[model samples]
Target: MSKLKNIFVFFGPPGSGKGTLAWLCVKRLGFVQLSTGSLFRRHINEQTDIGKQIDFTIRSGKLVEDSVVSKIVTEWLENAAHEHSSIILDGYPRTKNQAETLSQFLSEKFSSVKVCIVRLQISDEKLVERLGKRVVCAEKSCQKVYSLIENSSHKPKQTGTCDICVGKLIQRKDDAPEAVKKRLAVYHSHENELIDFYGENGVTIEDFNAADLVERIFEKFLCRFGFSIR
Candidate 1:
């Protein structure tokens, strides 16, 4: 039998540091990071068929169907399997049904795929503050992220240039306060049920406050995965 692989699912409210932490983990552990949001954004920017479909759904204020999302995720997993690498899934399996589907799919594909679900707990006020200051690069290949409020950590050198790619940074339409609030509502409505599904499946669910230092949170996650940070 093939060795078991690690699969991490990051759960959090909008503006929670899930994306940041996922990137950090991927960089440190060589985990393939899969984020539905990033996938959709990339597709939409490329104007692919799937991108058009997602665009229509978003513009119409309708949720993207689970079938489409599942297909995308499954395809990615299949590709990752060929490489014999683990993955970190971000902003996926938003509902209980999706979580169940993923669990079954992974069970069949791998001898033993241990899943770890991490939830970043943060207050609504802090979330609002975080989202309001977030910015992203406009270039297709340069989607660098930055925060205006948290100038202490990192800031773009220029008004538009991305610190990573030197591409122009722009605010996404969905990042507006009104849109953020709606997204938050949708997130909270389904989060509890999703959490329960993972918990019931014996998946380790760790909750950490967003205020905790990034290094501290990373250390905890590494420890959970039997890895020690140097």
Candidate 2:
């Protein structure tokens, strides 16, 4: 088995099952998730320095400056080193500049620079529907996600609490109908350029159904790491 650490980068729109898939992957496999969206929310919600710095940018329906996003992600990854050997990255590297920054950082951090970059391709209609009713765990460590509009498999036992942790579940700001529209529009604008940037860096990219079952999605995601979900 390869001992080198692996970073799985997942690209998807707000409600394209990216978070649910990340949660599923972490549950089934040993990998931890490093979600930019989660980080941003924590920052903004807490009104921390970095969160305050990027709050306006996010609320304006624009991408946060690459420097701010990159710095936050780098700090998170650096701190996560001792806790997890594998990481599933979601919501970072939305732009080519961020991709370049990540490429350089990953090259230095891991023995092999090759990464499994997965893109969950979904339609705009589906994304809106999914985010409109998406439920997220309030607990930081427990990111169990469910979409009431879709994915019957991940519905929690309680009305508004996580099935596992019993944490309160809330809809993400970006998951609101209006926010979904803005985020999706931004996604479409930058998706292709990011793909091209990744291709130029020579990382392997995989495309999957954005609407697949959580278990099935992670099954394929784990395959890239030579892992299987039980």
Candidate 3:
């Protein structure tokens, strides 16, 4: 049998640029990105039964059931699209139970699974500011990321418009100040659970600043992957 490969698990706040980093992992490093949020959104767009259930849970502002989520992800893993790909899991295994589910699944299916968890550390104050000022392209097909914060490279030349498609930039509902606070609260409540779980299970867990530029973080994480990849 082929040797098992290391899987990546990303932990961070919503606006901490985890998605951007995941994209870099896929584009530059040949890792397939698996984002549960995007998975839910895509299913909802397709109007499948699982998608509608997820849509209802999201509309009610509650986390999806752990078993359901794990099953959905497992199904995705077994799909032909990512059958032979290295995976970078974004926004998954939120609770201890969920993490356990993943562990059990890996053991049963792959014999052994190695994981490295990268936690993007950002202060609550910075998270609030970044999320609140965030805007994305209104065109679904060309949804590009942009920020009003001056430090961002994606900052538009004209402001409030996507540079690529000339589409209006829309702030996501979850980017509202109150919504951001709620998300931070949820993260804090369960953050230690995942951290402790990984540590006890002998998985490598590293924390890096989410406030850094994506390019800088990308460069740093590439080094982290160096020792593991080959």
Candidate 4:
């Protein structure tokens, strides 16, 4: 069996471009991205009982219950750890308790793997602007995210249409400006505590300023890790 190399934990609030950064790694570095948001979206799209619950919580700008989040993440990690050599974890461990739980689980199941915690730092003002302009494909299977901001590289070829699947684009309920502010508030409350927990556990947290272009961020990421696609 192939051993997992690095499990990248991407830390950032909503609209910080974590998904875009994850996509760049997937495209250029052949890493598998396990996005909790995408997983929740799948459940929500299916309208499962849990999906309904998650949908309600998300629409109200609240975090899903920790028990629900942990169960979903644990199941994902069980399969992904065995199948993928490298993985990027997007939006999983949001709070210090979740981080502690994840740390214990990884030690027990995949102790050999390296955990790389990267925190994307950006201003709340920038995040609000970004979220306000963000749109996603309406099709659940092709929920490609796009930015309507004039200077953003994630824009689709045609307005209001997905480039890959031609699905209609719409802003997510959680992406509303007011909802974004609420999400950011919740994030800031636990952000420092989560960082401190990792530090106390002897883990290094890599911080990156996310105001730069995606391409530039990708370049800096590679240089920091000295990673090569080839």
Candidate 5:
């Protein structure tokens, strides 16, 4: 209930269910979820000025310049601060430099931003299987996700459109085996260093099994962050 805003960074390898849990936390805790991947994709799909720039950046296999990424995120944060007390950032700060920039930005914006880092821990084998079978909606507003292998409980309806936005579901270009391996290589190169940076900054890093039951994951999140359902 503190007026001080909270910022949570969800950390995990691909197929760790970080997005799923992040969405749950956002709904239950009223936190705005900011995802770098989703943001970039949104822009690209919209073909906005910024999105066009990002498309070029991605095609070259180069990181989006920090200035561009920071500008977009800062604008969103400034707007959210006026209406919400906290925000959840997923799939961001993949590098130490980005993490440092975010830390400085928050320190300047809020009196004391409570930063929490949650690392979803799952076996590599499991992650590979899960991500390989994952399906993502192509639509921006209706980016409903489905797992063809592990998500037996939530089956995709016969309709090719997402239930939420009627957007067509499609396999991401990077979801293929070779692409996934390349991404994993890139992630491993910097993820540990980024994790260390946050830990050194006093960000709480909690490990949880993302492959567990939904209720169990929810309980773990609440227990670690000391939030309760209304």
Candidate 6:
């Protein structure tokens, strides 16, 4: 089996640029990016056993059990372990229980893998401001995110259109100013608890200012891992 190197767990609230940083790592370093949301969708589309469980839970208006989510993730890691060295985990292990579960699984199965819990920090006010200006391509297959902020690197070349797919750009309902505030409130509630748990467990933790531009944030992430831009 190929030796896995690093597992980067990106912990951040919404609008903190976790996706952008993960995308950059994948593009630049050829690291495998694993997102729980994407995995859920892929499993459901393929009608896997775990997918059926997730679908049932969602349709019944209940969150999937932490054990179920962890199972699917570990299964994916087992399959991907032989091929990928560096892995970027985005939007998983949201709670302390989930984090503990993942930690145990990694220690037992992938003992040699280095885990880095990267905390992407930004003020809730700034998050609200940033998300409020966010827009995405309306095309289902080309849901590229963009921002209306003048200095954002993700601004579309043409107003109201996606630069890549030429699809109409629309603001997500969840990105509304009021909605963003609600989301941030929920995130802040348990943010410290999660941080404390990771620290207590002796996991390698790093903090980065996520309010910076995407390029700058990517550069910092690379520097943290001793990677240089190719």
Per-model TM against the reference: 0.73, 0.68, 0.78, 0.73, 0.75, 0.87
- Against the unseen true structure, what C-alpha lDDT does each candidate score? 0.79, 0.79, 0.83, 0.86, 0.78, 0.87
Give the best candidate by lDDT: 6
Candidate 1 backbone collisions, by pair: none
* Best model number under TM-score: 6
Give the RMSD in angstroms, all C-alphas superposed, for model 6: 2.5
lDDT string for model 3 (55-93, tens) is 999899998999889988887766623354468787778
Residue 181, candidate 1: alpha-carbon lDDT: 85
> What would you estimate as the lDDT of candidate 4?
0.86
Instruction: Encode model 2's per-residue lDDT on 153-188: one tens digit a residue.
Output: 667777888988889999988788888888778888
C-alpha displacement of 20 in model 4, angstroms? 0.6
Q: State in Å the error of residue 61, model 1.
A: 6.8
Arrange candidates by lDDT, descending: 6, 4, 3, 2, 1, 5
- Looking at model 4, residue 49 earns an lDDT score of 86
What local lDDT score does residue 52 receive in model 3, on the 0 to 100 scale?
93
Rank order by TM-score, top first?
6, 3, 5, 1, 4, 2
TM-score for predicted model 4 compared with the true structure: 0.73
Candidate 1, residue 223: the lDDT equals: 75
Q: Residues 1-230, candidate 4, lDDT per residue (tens digit)?
A: 64577988888877676778999999988889887888889899999888899999999999799878887788788887767888998766877778888999889888888888888999999999888899999999999989899967788899999999999999998989889899999898878788888888888788888888767788889999888767
Worst 10 residues of 3 by lDDT: 77-86
Query: How well is each residue in 1-230 modelled by candidate 1, as lDDT tens digits?
Result: 33337787888887777777888877887778877887888889999898899999999999898877887788778777666456888778877778888988888887477787888998877777677777899989778778776453757777667877778788787887888888888898898898877777778887887767677788877776677545
Off by over 4 Å in 1: 1-4, 37-62, 134-151, 155-178
Cα error of candidate 5 at position 26, Å = 2.1
Per-residue CA lDDT of candidate 5, range 1-230, in tens? 33547887787777777777877877888878887787889889999899999999999999899878987787777777777777888767767877888888888877577887877877766666767777878998677786676337655774455766777878787787778888777777777998889878877887888778656887988987788999
Off by over 4 Å in 3: 1-4, 37-63, 78-82, 136-145, 159-173, 227-230
